[model samples]
Target chain A: MRILVCVKRVPAPGSRINVTPDSLNVDTNHLGFTTSPHEECAVEEAAQIVEQHGGGVTVLTVGPSEAEEQLRYAASVGATAFVLVSNDTGIDWDPQQTADAIIESIAELEADQGQFDLILFGNESADSGGHQVGIRVAVALGRPAVNGIKGIEVGVQGVTARREVDGGYEVYSLEIPAVLGVKEGINLPRYPTMKGRLASKKAEISARETQVAPGAQQRRRLHQPEETVIETEILGTSSDAAPKIVDLLEELGVL
Target chain B: MAGVYVVVEHDQGQLAPSAGEALTAARRLSDHLNEPVIAVVIGEATTEFVSLCEEHGIPKAVSVLDPQIVDYGPELWGQAMAELFSLTEARVVMATGTDRGNEILAQASARAQIPFVANCINAEFSGAWELTRMQWGGSLLEDVTLDTSSLFISYAHHSVEAEPLAAASATQIESIEMNLDPVLCRSLVQDRVTLSEGTTLSTAAVVVSGGRGVGSAEGFASLEALAGLLSGKVGCSRAVTNNGWRSHADQVGQTGTRIAPDIYIACGISGAIQHWVGAMASKNILAINTDPEANMVTKAGYAVIADLHEVVPAIIAEIERRRGNSTST
Candidate 1:
């Protein structure tokens, strides 16, 4: 089945993310961006689905033209085409507008390409970390939406998705034309290959107008919180200290 | 009153602590916004769910229950909740920045076609109308003025300290008829299994955790035995879970559940920040490792320099022997 994967550019993990002094938004001047970890996994899953099922795959992003790099990154990993949807500035749009933009961008792509049998996305964006777009877009399209997915399988019958829930994994078997939001641990995303990188640079993409504008909506005054720290020292250890440690854990309520 | 919307999360008749945390934050944010805090609980049943709102100090509780809404389905929830948001026209709708919370807000944002800020740790109003929420994982702050009839945000539950509960009379609760249909929900919970015993490590007061140094799967039984003795929950590092030595639900790290236990006894844990972020909120930490320089040792309240294979058994024996007469605390 054909697939459409939504990718996002986010600050890489392990890097410190700083907010403005007002705390209403991120301080983006210094931070580096990469494919949101979960989105990378989504790309891997889509590639796997296409490889096994013999179908087309399209990587789409609704950000500044710079986000084409993110789609290229997806193409390097195995996506068929990269589509960039932006107006030059990747202004901060809320999750709703972002999803609206995705729906529009997908429609524009489908108008030219064939309809997608499935749409894949990350469970939550590592940078923005809101995790609202995928399911919201699913609602707009009225498709089956699954989040926290750890494993996925597609076959002659249909598509099967598994996600971690309360105790164990919950497996859902649904017909095609569904949206699956991948979690980080689904599978370690593969690095981009040299051949894939070369192909991505030359990939052709069409631009379309999005009804939703990032700045169209209003926001409020942003302020930072006071930093509170409790300084303490680590105590030494000993066989005799086991009792003391127990006492401390009990006080801390661990014992 | 310009109402504050408090969004709560529950699955299979179980409530997540983030829901209460959201209420605690809402109680304060509402006061600051000059509005009343109203709790909105979405579930298939309202009998017990509504009472939980009274505990959160909610004056008005709206319960929308439909069998089709069992799992964390965004469409059904967004349909019911968006209708509520339109009716209440809340100054702001805040849910805990959880997987499900983000999903609902995303759907609500689409339906309302509004803007939403995610992972906001703190926000202060400059006047009757503007909000500035910090981004970049609490590293920097952005200042922006908001202009919308309703504002949507998912407050990172870890950011706000849980507000202390106040003893007061019961609050008024009005149940809203759910206008959603079973056939309308495309996705479903399908199945739900209640944690029979020893779940909820995130909120547990004490956690008896074992890491890679504990050796094999047989070694876990000893840790479980110790956990059972203390009435504490069991937790593991990401490595242990990856090795299939323990369940994923009990894993603690950047990818796993973030825990705020009162006392965290990390046995054989090296104390990486990835692991620390998950349990750094502990009132006191006791990390036992053979290596004196284990990273977690430096942050630990008391670092026991010893082999956990030897130390854990001894500690267990001591607890069993001293059952009644220990003044260590």
Candidate 2:
């Protein structure tokens, strides 16, 4: 019943995202970081599974050294183990390189401890949104994988996963040692308690390393899309605006 | 000869909404690369599917109809696509950037040991593949170069309008034979559970969305009333969901449902980038907030600088009054 969750540290974007002068990375001077929303739910889902199945959850991440903060956050929220596949390089790794590094690290961890029964990942990173790492990892490992999973249930023989589709859900059953990419709506993650925070501060974090190779895709630059400034027509400033709104709705054929 | 391949998504014997859009993208690539475009269908390419393709100006298509692939499985579809890529020596593979579309293409590209890009808005080949893709849900754009000659990419949803060729010829559908491994079926869809019947958030024509200013879960009552009166749906921002005032199912943002309604009524929302990316696709936006300087108010097509609590009830009453007068007449 051992479970592993993979997460990414992303800057919590406000109303707007500002890029660095070089356009190579996000300007992080005043920005704060948090685990991608989807991966936070993945960590929560893994922890809840272990809580009910009588096992431990391991949280893993691949990012800069500062990502250790995210790993510690996971520990505070029911993760029993932490693995940081350190990427000290300032430049972001391509999807292929990231997937390769994660696959190699997973093999190393399994060599030390027994193989995990399940591994979970966010459907896509909030920043890059490549939507490939989990599927690539599963394909390399020859394990069943599905993305956009919102529901999961563990049974005696296999695990049942539900992927949200239009107007319904598509359910799949896979044997143990499977991979899944969970979305944000899967669960509402809990906040860290005082005791959990203290424990996480003292918890040990395992750091792993991988060789970097040039990936097929390389980022040239990042730029913001030109914002179209619309001349917003003010309907009114008080309840009297309601009639104007109704008239506009009628013009839009909504009424 | 190397050709461009586009994977068409279908459901319940009809082409999915993004099918034509994906083909349009492939057609663009095909014209620029001077290669033939072929549509690949994982399921049976029925007469209706062929007609739809023909209507969309598809010149050629390959149908991979295997009994083992009765249900959708990422691995199975990936392998099938991988086989097709090798058999045809495809130069480019494209699909719509959907959950299933991205999954299947990712798996296929992995099997082919090639690079895959998602949410690409534009792509061109000068010498190598240069792509402009949407990052942060279209708030930002990333220009990247794919070193590989064989390209695998997904078009950003709604990036290109679906248009049929000016003079499209009869579409030719050819069935291809492949040896699919049964192990891939491990990821096959085993069951389906219908959550709700019709008019979900994504499909709703008009969406009345609330944000943090809506106050609490109970505060969504006016929103629900407005949506019901408009025969639309009710949505909330991520803040409302995080506050535990609304379920995540009702959230509308980059992390939530990407909605494309005719008109999106945003109430009490400050309009963060995450939320704006989802609502930007709507034809028109009307923001009702007390703060005139809010992002939602400034970016919206129309605005009412007032408290939603006060304005929503008034709007509802006005609509009812207009309706009653028309009925009396």
Candidate 3:
């Protein structure tokens, strides 16, 4: 019944995103950082599973030392233990390198505390959106894995996962010791309580280092896409604009 | 090293919408590389599907028809693709960046011990293969260089328009027999549960969407009313869904439904990149928000700088008034 969840720290973007002057990274001078939305839900789901099944949930992240913020945030909610696979967190490790580092960290954790029954990850990191790290880890571990899962039901010996499809959903059943890449909306993450905040401040975080080199995909630069300039006809303001809206709707033939 | 490869996806005996576009992308790579375009189709494919390949400029396709391959199994499909790559010696492999497409390609890349890239908008060889891919949905772009013996990538959804060759070459479907490993079917799609009956978010003609400024679940009532009057559907942003104000099924974003309605009325939405990617496909957009600098307001075709609480009811009343006058007359 033991579960592990992986998360990443990402810059919380506003209405617009700007690249660094060197074109290497996101300009985060004016932005705050938060756990990727999908991974936040993953941590919540893991906590709920342990609450029902009576097991500990361990949160893991492979990023720079600053990512300890995300680890502590996981503690504030429900994660009982934390592991940070520390590296130069300023830059992103390609998907292959990231997966390799995670697999090595998982081995070390399992050596200390028996094997985890299930491991969860965000469907994709908000910033990189590589969509492969979880699956790559699953393959390397020789376990069944599914991505884009929204619904999960733990049974006695297996798990039922539901992925959203066009009309309904496609369900899959995998035995224990499996991995899953869950998306947001799988569950509503709970807010941290005052007592939980105090406990998280005292929690100890274990750090691990990775020596894996960068993979084949090397980024040259990041840039904002050219915005299409639209005139954006402002009809009016407040309720006075209602008549103009009706006229426009009529012109568009929706009325 | 011999040709460019594309994995064709089909469901219920018809080609998926992204299949033709993937083939067209492969055609571009094939022509540039001066190599043939070889499509790999697992399981059954209709005649129309094969014709689609030809129309999209695919020179040859390899089909594997096996009972175990009848259903969608990520591992099995991945193995098929890995085998096809070795069998064909494909120089580059690409698929559409759908959930299934990304999964199978990732699996294949893992088995082949190669790096894979997703959501690529464009790629070409300039001393090296330079790729321009979408990051943060479609709001930002990243220029990357992938140094691999055989390239693996997926095209961004709806990024490339599907085009037919002016003079299509007669496409031949060659049967490449494969006895897939039975163990690979462990991850097969086991069951299906229908959440709603019909007229889902992606299929709606008009979509009235709400965001964090919608306040709460009950606050969505006005949006629902507007959608109901227009016989459309109601959608919300990820923020609203995360706040427990609406169901994930009602969310509009990169992780949720990608909708292309006739008109999308966005209320109280700041329009983050994730949400904008899904709504950008709508033919027309109207934003009602207090912040005139919001991304949705700036990108919209029309805007009203006011609170939706006031604007929505007024729009509803005006429509009803006009309807009553015409009926009375």
Best-performing candidate as measured by TM-score: 2
Q: Which residue pairs collide, candidate 2?
A: none
Give per-residue CA lDDT, model 3, range B21-124, as digits (tens). 88888888788888888887887656877888878767688787667886888888888888888877888778988887888899888877777889998888
DockQ head-to-head 1 vs 3, winner: 3
lDDT of each: 0.70, 0.90, 0.87
What tens digits encode model 1's per-residue C-alpha lDDT throughout B1-329?
A: 26878787887567776766888888888888778888887764355555666666677776676656656665678777777787777778878887678777767766766667666665556553344444433433444555555677777757776664676347666667765756446655554444544556876777878888887767888778877777778899866866778866788765676777777788888865446667766777778887777767766766788777766776777677677655543
Model 1 chain A is weakest, by summed lDDT over 10 consecutive residues, at A227-236
Give candidate 2's error at residue A156 in angstroms.
0.6
lDDT of 2 at B134: 89
Query: Residue pairs in steric clash, candidate 3?
Result: A64-A89
Q: What DockQ does each prediction reach against the true complex?
A: 0.34, 0.88, 0.72
**Number of the candidate with higher DockQ, 1 or 2:** 2
All candidates: TM-score: 0.79, 0.99, 0.95
Q: Candidate 2's error at B101, in angstroms? A: 0.8
Scored by TM against the true chain B, the candidates give 0.80, 0.98, 0.91
